[model samples]
Target: MANNDIEVGSRGSLPRKDYFEPLPAPMIDMEELAKWSFYRAIIAEFVATLLFLYVVVLTVIGNKTQTDPIIGGNLCGGVGTLGIAWVFGGMIFVLVYCTAGISGGHINPAVTFGMFLGRKISLIRALLYIIAQCLGALCGCALVKSLQRDRYNHYGGAANQLVDGYSKGTGLAVEIVGTFVLLYTVFSATDPKRNARDSYVPVLAPLPIGFTVFMVHLATIPITGTGINPARSFGAAVIINDKEIWKDHWIFWVGPLIGATIATMYYQYVLRASAVKAIGSFRSTPPTRH
Candidate 1:
């Protein structure tokens, strides 16, 4: 999800001048279905997503358990909101690092959706990847439930909920903006052009990606519980199965999806200046024969 997009596209004028090669992945690359690497990538996505959801959900439940004196027996307060943010962010950093080589480390559906819109991945691959991620997330939450059904049920399954004061729209807004921050960071971090031009600059892709998630959660956790990743939201919702959780469920999916779309367009047209490149290509003069 961070560092492995193919680079073969229009290198207008001098290859160095183009800055990026935008190869639109085929819409239906059936050939990928036959490859072992494709299946390998799918499995990687599954396990990575599973671990991501598993750890984050567990941390959330644990924090709630400790914070409530009635339940925790005055456990000296739980790992507060700050700690929860760290766990989410830290786990992302660890998981992305671990699986990036295998499946580009796409543990989140929003990241995969953004990549799809940018044509970085084939439609078939993107679809399957999303399915695998969602299932993995479900299993991860289910794991937490299986281990401590009472505790899990006690903590409301850690499903994202719109806080008491916020309106549904406000909750939706946070999800969109939070996801935008995350997806935008993903695009900027994995930019092939930046990587090529600034080869000497030492930067780890996973670091920023993880930090973006952490920061977004910090700001929006109180709003919509920060559903920047659709798969993350979906898993928790499915496992919890409480009627109340379903009330704002649409916000989780819609907000992240819309945010991803915006980020994809913003990166391609505004930040990357794809529009400028197109106009330049149309206007450039052909060299006359010597």
Candidate 2:
């Protein structure tokens, strides 16, 4: 009867167990040095981040220029706020789809850090990805400045700033909550159990992540220019060289990182139940002298 009950339950329409990977042991191995694919992954992150910032920042600059009567007038009608949000969300979807297999498609440092804390990536790889992303962002912003030259200055160079009437505390909170939404979505979308259970999920994976970015921007842009990615904010700050940007710059880094850390902990421990096992392990140690 117990065996029959177990069988019947298995056949029922109940949800299955959540997927969770074992925590990765830290290592610095020569194999990573020997692998060509590691370098390729780094390059993918660079290019993806570069493309992301370039297109999005260009849109921002163009919008500012168009709205300025002294410059564009009615000719450059601009895409407006809604269009800017779409550009950011759309670019992320396309980029993630293209680079998911090779680089895990982490275009943001905060995302990479979140994955690192979750043990989804190695420490070495995480560090490298962050460096590549920052460099890529710098190059992207530089290109926009180079092309626009005069307009870049007039339009504020797409720098993220705390707008009038909003306090720094409010700005910081926006980045934190906005980034938590994005990172949490990435975790849930890529959860192995979710994919194993639903074959159709792979095709729709990027959509929710992109939509999260879009929605977050719509709510937070007026407050802090929607800086969920630290590298993106830093890139613009470097190029614009504005003291105000520099003063509030720490909020971008601190907020997103805090959000990512929280997401990593929640998804790994609570949602995935990764700590169910407390078994001990043994490893060989060097012999001690007498």
Candidate 3:
């Protein structure tokens, strides 16, 4: 019944109507998204830094009042220098957990500069982070001053300085070693291979790192009031306006930077090589695409 000499297969096919179906909205550029994410991270870092400094300064002020009451009394009124160390260590732990994913939780400029030196961050990014951290610290100090303008003479806000008998060299040594331990723990805990399971690390990372800061403060508090973090010291010192404190501030910066640099390099090159090798081997395996 078909027409004779008509060949259905001989006709070329027409395009499908669905070919004009609306395409999904264009996807965002991942590079632009990453840049935006990084900007957010920096802002988070600023917020974290402000919170950390505020808590520390307030604690120091509180403890100073506790200690000052008993000049020569039978009872020791203050929690003592060791207690201050614990305060700092504990605060750091809480802050890190709250902001680690967002900003790598570097509330300290020394830590940031150290990471920068280790090539973990780009120069421009590092610069931005440092500015944010410094500004945050300054703002925290300003807040303390505003709140206690009438009580400044009594509180002093936990500024750091060399003890009466301690020399500059001794203070520097303490800071370097103390910061080395703190930063080493930071590198280890945040390291993907070291804490391969994210759940385990989020819980475990803060303890050791926090305790290390506490222990370091205990050992060095007598020597330099334990200014392992220059930002912390700077925050308090600016409010106190002690010229001597400002003069000695360079040691805190230099020591922590040196220690962090060494620790980061050791972690990146020596400790992580095996993990790197494993990842490389996995990538090199050819896939059997069926």
The candidate that achieves the highest TM-score relative to the unseen native structure: 1
Q: How close is candidate 2 to the true structure, as a TM-score?
A: 0.87
Score every model by TM-score. Answer: 0.89, 0.87, 0.78
Candidate number with greatest lDDT: 1
Candidate scoring better on lDDT of 1 and 3:
1
- How do the residues 1-290 of candidate 3 rate in per-residue lDDT, one tens digit apiece? 11111112223653222111122122333353468777887888778778778877777776676656444422266667777788889988888888877778888877887777655666666777788887778778778777877555465666887888888898888888888888888877765433432337657777787888899988988888887787788777877887777888888788888778777777765775533543453344443322
Ranking by TM-score: 1, 2, 3
| Candidate 2, residue 56: how far the Cα is off, in Å | 0.5
lDDT scores of the candidates, listed in order? 0.84, 0.84, 0.71
lDDT for each residue of candidate 2 in 205-241, tens digit (9 for 90 to 100):
8888899899999999889999999989989999888
Off by over 4 Å in 3: 1-34, 70-75, 197-199, 273-290
Q: Using lDDT, rank the candidates from best to worst.
A: 1, 2, 3
Q: Give the local distance difference test score of model 2.
A: 0.84
Global lDDT of model 3: 0.71
